[model samples]
Target: MLRFDDLQLFVRTAETGSLSAAARLLEISPAVASAALKRLEVQLDVRLFARSTRSLRLTAQGELFLEYARLALQNLEDGRQLLAGSKAGISGLLQLSAPSDFGRNTLLPWLDEFQQAHPQLHLRLLLGDRVSDLFREPVDIALRYGAPEDSSLVALPVAASNRRVLCAAPEYLARHGQPQSLSDLARHNCLLYMLGGRVHERWRFFDGKRELSQSVSGDRLSDDADVVRRWAVAGVGLVYKSWLDVAGDVRAGRLKVLLPEWRGEPTPLNLICAHRAQLSTPVNLLREFVQARCAELLAHAPWNA
Candidate 1:
């Protein structure tokens, strides 16, 4: 005899850590959420939460009930989706996040095509270099580069890209002379990308059967990939950049690839989502579209030559 609405309110409150936050997600008044919890507790004849002036903590009984509630709601949602099946066209607001450069250069064009295909779906994209917190943010999906550390979330590997190529403008290479070996890199000005707390100044190369790592220095450093690309094109310094970002420039003769024989291991691109049994039709559609595009890009990577 538990109400579905009451159960939803309770689950939202537990997930959000407060009734006020749950109300905001549900688009209801806090008082209404509080009343629903009160009624649910009364009906169950159990104290669900131990409330203090500052915070609300779930009781032992509440914790046990929450697990069941989460599973039941997920099952119900799955059932609804199953019933809808492929007949259900994507139609809902989807929030997404991705790294700035890749999102603009890669995802933006594909998204335009996707929106045209699914006119009913509304999409909101947030672009930044920093990773987004899926639990705290109202995001449906996130596109992440490299590997993900969170084992709790579901990650789908969509595409693969190479680490970076050390390159420079023809004029710069002509004046400075191209580095013939890893040891020679020390003689040339190197542009570095800062990752985490470490500056990625070490260049790794594959020489037929062996791998080499060399430490290099530069007068310029940046966390932004686009800025690094511009600097390299302006003949400021040699830059290490993703093949996808620099491929067009290299093809157009604006930039030249320094080491054609030596290449690094491929980096992975992933589509991440919250670990849940039920995902909306709209989210699934977008994920599929992205996966398809990723495959296309991987097949035609400029560095494959």
Candidate 2:
């Protein structure tokens, strides 16, 4: 018979790509973990991993088994928690990743409120412009700006109504004059956000049934999105950014929305995870909370008027 511990070890090893690392995480000796895996393989009559000196990879059978194993373990854990009254409370370290600008400007306060409500729950947040690989990273979840392009991810829609908006400071327009049309944007200085070594200078928009992407240029670019927004506020250049990221600036009269008749491309927000099994009670609660907050913010947005 296969032990439950063996199932856990197998999953962790597959996730971490090393048995020793999984053993350390489980607080067990590597030898014991090795024996447990051997026992499991003997019972199942299938090799779960193909091991090399420097790496370990799941076999085809192991890949298939891993999905079921994760589902089984999650179900068992859910049942245990419910029986133990742990389901009534949210307590655990939730490792999360998010884009830097939204994480700092928007999510920080929301996270504080969440923490206040669930004091027992701990959070480890990583902020970056790059997408986090959930299978490889130690993150339980990630807040992404766009839809999950990878089919392997399970994306829960948090802000479907979110869209990008093009804006420039009044000072910039005063000095450079306002762009009269889409063609006019090319003549203006555009601020750019850099991601993965590429400057996102191609601005997309929707005019009625037609979609358009214009190649924009700027005198300055930064990997940090907040810096790009700051540059736009200082009248340095025009910027295309998420409405949520610039809503406050727009309201404060620091930035004025341009091309109001034309719509910027939609960039819906998603709460993404590796597996649906990872959506425990607290995760689900957080998802709902974020979705509601985003809706509230958009509802009161000055640009919406």
Candidate 3:
């Protein structure tokens, strides 16, 4: 394989038009530079220089190879600069995965602000409810609800106190009457969402003393959580989702919190990744940005108020 140092020396020699001057510029002996040039010529089986005592000049073959050698050196320099910038936390592209509803309704805005703040940074977002395989997928990180079910992955808490809320539109409540208790949910049409190919018909809540899990059914089900939220807004049925996902609707009175006394079990938001090494500068910055924004948003949520 051709060495980069050889390419650098060849380009420098061509620019200086003197083997001794190029060697001096590169902080090497003239003899070493001469030997290196000879090795390069022998490797390619071509005479690179028409030598004279006055000064060296590039031969026909040398001129052709000089351009290619300069290009190779320039590309290597560019790569080195990129690595240097990365070390200083300057620029990078972060590939991320997030749940569909939260990714769209919550994270999309946050991402916009984060991107605007760092113009050199780029982002690739995979929005869906399906659990992404961090090891297999090209994603560098993921925004997930609850603790990671995969014990091997590292989960960093982004929102330590985020919780789901069960809500319904005022129009739907007026038609079917409000559900006063967990048992009352059975009589109501509960909208279901899909996550990782399974219907999320089972709802879990905390009643101050213990955890409660209830199985619910509805006339409609959707793989997209945002669709389920929209159905609730349209007064099709009840929706249980992250308070962050429907905070705007609740504040707008498009949906009302059901059973305010009982809160759903806290499903802490986490930044998930296959390994700790994946938490590079851009990924870590994004994690901190999202965490701070989530805290601010949840604090001002209508349900929290």
Tell me which residue pairs clash in candidate 1.
Answer: none
lDDT of 3 by residue, 1-305 (tens): 77877776787777667887779867999898988988999999999989888868888999888657755654564465457665344465577999988899888988999888887777889998878877445466899988888999899999888889999999999999999889889889999978667898899988678888998999999998999999999999999999878888888899998888888867788999866655666777788889998898789754466
- The predictions' CA RMSDs to the true structure, in order, are 4.1, 3.1, 15.1
Better of 1 and 3 by lDDT: 3
lDDT of 1 at 272: 82
How well is each residue in 115-194 modelled by candidate 1, as lDDT tens digits?
Answer: 88877668889887667776545566788777767888888776655456678899898899998876888988988766
TM-score, cand. 1: 0.74
Go through the candidates in order and give each one's C-alpha lDDT.
0.76, 0.86, 0.83
**Which lDDT tens digits does candidate 2 get at residues 74-187?**
788667556656533777667789888889988889999998988877898999888887876667799998877689899989988788888999999999999888888899
Residue 122 C-alpha lDDT in model 1 = 80
The 10 consecutive residues of candidate 1 with the worst lDDT sum are 84-93
Error of 1 at 135 (Å): 3.2
Model 3: residues >4 Å from true position, as ranges? 1-89, 301-305
Pick the winner on TM-score between candidates 1 and 3.
1
